[model samples]
Target: MRKLILAIAAALPSAAVAGGYIVPNTNPRDLSMAGSAMAAQDSAGAAYANPAALSKLEGLNVTGGVSLIDFRSTWTDSARIADGQAVTMIPKGAFPFVLFAGYGLKLANGMKLGVGGGVNIPGGGYSFWPGNWPGRYQIVTVDRKVYGMYLTSGLQIMPQVRVGGGLVYYRTTEHLIQGINFLGYDSSAELGTSGGAVSFDLSTEVQPLKTIPLTIGVDYKHQAVQHLSGHGHFDNPPPALQGYGVVDQPATHVLTYPNRLEVGASYQVIPQLLVTAQWTWERFHVYKSDVFNGGLGFSLAVNRDYKNGYTLRLGGEFQALPQLKVRGGILRDISPVRPETLDPTLPEANVWAGALGVGYEVMPGLQVDAAYFHAFYDTITAAGADQAFPGTYDTRANIWSLAVSWKTDLLQRRK
Candidate 1:
């Protein structure tokens, strides 16, 4: 039974590792270009990726899209008596959906304005672990959901320069179930929490030369921390471990969303082709929270020591035909959680990614976009100190997106 309690402990730390959540590509067009929207963006998506882009539009534009993520992983126990055998304790895959929308308007004052928003699913993952599985005593199941919303604006300072910013909000819900061992008896508890937070984002773009189709873009976003409060229901437990038979106790937690910055450039080598590159830095070190004061003033401490993370992305778009465009790109994503902080609650690892997509000009003012992306993660083997959940994790993910955009001159003032 003691082993069961320790196993549960191994999975608990991950519940607080929310700072590692990655927002998958929300725009189908952006996904196809491997999320290289920092500078080479068109349509209303610019409202979120780089609002300054709104100033380049001719009239009014609206863009909307939906994305589906398929995440899968394989976990193994090195200490297995069967000599390093794979464990089938958890679900093999999870599917999550993302939605996005943006609108841009070109005013008569030579200024551009735009608004955009999106719904992101916490990257796909499994929350269920079998009670009889080797690691069941450590964790039975964990489920979490997070939603984000934002309103953004942009202004064109000159024909070749623009700047923009926005306010963002988030809501979160979580549920956890784990088995506990005490006095030779096995019991379980169900815990849940809900909370929200608000943050901000800023961005800018510049064109240095008029003769070259080259542009530079920079973007930044503030950090947000969610203060969650809820309760836990303890199932039947040994008398020595339970104050009252199957009672409830207060539960509270905090999740820190990291701050991030991105800088990139895009160039149109020719009238029919565009290429881009970008780098992103994330401050995941802020994910330090060893304790939380509950509703009744009791403290619950959970340690999480994480490092900063980074990502590099490159992409291109080619005008294959008068009515169709082809896109492709690649990226490298790094993880912030060190080996010691790695846990099964949400296994995270560095990844290499590739994408492909296409755009169809269905009509004079309407376009449709579709894209697919795949991420290949490095196999992680944890066996030393800080390897709280000592095991091996193989992870990978795939994403599919589709969107439609429309533009019209109706919003322009009649001459």
Candidate 2:
């Protein structure tokens, strides 16, 4: 009975972590370049991509955008009796949306600063699976939402070096449902929670050579630890299990968002061509376990054993016309989830992605950007990972984005 309760508590965190919660880039131009915009800091997105690059701007800048994400996934039980039938799952509404907005300014004193905010699906993928699916015992439905706000500042301390930092605040809400089997009878468990955390990031940009149009950028984001308190409800427990911590009660848990490091370089190979390459690393190993505390002195812990993950990105932009820019890029993202810790709720695998985008100057100080991105995930087959659940998992995703940016030289106007 205690074991079953622990399993219910454990499933909640896995569901949140395994839902592709991390968004690579929210800006349309950055996404179009496969997230390789760290060093090419010409857009307002530099506020989030590399705050140090904000120093490069000479005016007031604002950018707003939205991304529509379409995610699809399937799971197949490994049991012989189940044959090869697959269960499909998808988010429960119209295509999910990620939003971004940024504001930047270059002060009269030559100092630069920016404030950016956005809505990210970090843990908020409203995925729904059939109640009778083979993996129902693990997870049935999950609804989560996370929001972030960024305040940043940048300074060019030297002729060739710029440094910056930012503070981040995140708020999250989660609700999950999973099926339970008590002997032959069927039951269900539900958990709801909400919490917030604060974190920070630092960045630096450097120009090494006097005659070269090359810039190197490095950025680091600290980890955030969230403590959530909420309620847990269980239904249809057997008569014997009614009094044994099986009742509805208050619950609490802690979840840690990983820290990250990104290093990138951008160079202008020609007057009309710019290229960028970046490498990103995330410390996912912090997600070692889930500890849950419930009413009636019920406490349990479950191991996750996640590892660190990394990504490689390559991108380029070509000035095709005086008023138009063309962009394309590719990326390879490696997952941190291992076979030993694989769960139906966290079916993640390595992926390769490609993107294309275009920016058109609508007016002297206004531009419109649009992009399309697609990700191909490697199918995963996990056997003997769990006696109750073993299966194959496949996933696919696509993103479409649009944005408008406006910039004006405030100092120039004063002069």
Candidate 3:
């Protein structure tokens, strides 16, 4: 576990999004314009995106790939709370590698069974200027990190139906630091949580509607939480704020990933063209507590109007050439946390992303996958921004990632 933690930690140089909130949650490889698996045979990434898809593996296949992601963010005084604003710079890039081995066994009734495991960074980070950012974002280095992982299995119930499940683990830590010259504030807060749980998914391919090949999948992960314990201090909190004291909360979040529902379908638009789209939803708003909600020290309120967010991904792939595959996709996700709840420590908003990528099978199991994503920037004005420095801040981040794959065949039992 420690080694796994170290590997994952070393992988996320930029996986940590600013304000400790991550947008563009899907693997960059899947970011093509309409984001479903264009290469269904490419089950290598299934453990992270759709475990049920593992049933598609005909034999034992092992895949190991690494992605190099570059990120850049620049902030200006879009709100002009400051007299002169500068571009706030943070660390950039991520080095995430994926390794998984899945095998499908032929059952008595022509069914198949498979399993795999994967480690991924779900995304989140902390950033702050020591002094009041004369630019967009202002004050104190409040940093936090969130990591995710999965160990999974799949079963093909029928020739076209499959179900998969995973034992998932999530770890998060919040660090609140009073940056240099951060207003008159000299105190900060800290919170962290780690736990393991289970999640399940079901998928089926049907020919019910003539030309449409329907693929429906559902995923569910309950909020059987990990308790969070931490302490907080504030030198200038209002009198109503100081009594309850150092806040200690459960390691939980308001946009707690709830039971998710997914439905998708694909159609053969032409002899060589395929189109696919998928919809996913979770009752994120059900999470009202602010990590402090379930802790022994404080009272937290679930958001009354917040709901689990939703995403719509659409894309298609065309065999532009025998060796060249062209793909494009568009994705939108309703961010769970409101801008109002966005702390300088955690900033996020609904997201809109367009992706373009291609995979070239250099030779059989050896492949090269490259993807580029353009995520529309969302504006955030946090209380922590101006309050900590009596100024204003706005932030935006851009991402680009490339990956390589080498899949090993295990069915032949090669020595």
Candidate 1: misplaced stretches above 4 Å? 1-19, 81-83, 88-103, 106-109, 117-126, 236-241, 244-246, 413-415
Angstrom error of the Cα, residue 413, model 1: value is 5.6
Model 3 poorest ten-residue lDDT run: 4-13
lDDT of 1 at 397: 71
Q: After best superposition, candidate 3 residue 400: deviation in angstroms? A: 2.5
172-247, model 2: which lDDT tens digit per residue? 7778889998888999998888888999989999999969999999999888898988888887788799876777
In terms of TM-score, the best-performing candidate is 2
* Candidates 1 and 3, the one with greater TM-score: 1
Poorly placed runs, candidate 2 (over 4 Å): 1-6, 13-20, 91-126, 235-241, 385-387
Candidate 3: Cα lDDT at 150: 71
- Candidate 1 CA-lDDT value: 0.70
Clashes of each: 3, 1, 19
Residue-level lDDT of model 1, residues 169-278, one tens digit each, is 77777667787656567778777777889988899899999888899999887887888777776677666644433446566667766788889899998999999999
Return the TM-score for candidate 1, rounded to 2 decimals: 0.88
- Over 1-415, each residue of candidate 3 has an lDDT whose tens digit, in order, gives 1111111111111213321244344454565643565224346566656677777766666655555444434444545655456555465455655566666666777787777776665544545543444422222454444456677777778766677767776655555444222245333333333434444444444445544555555545444343434433334433444445322233333234355555666666775777778776666565554423333432434222344677787877788877668788877767665545443333455667677888788987766767776665465454433233222234454555555666555654553
lDDT of 1 at 11: 48
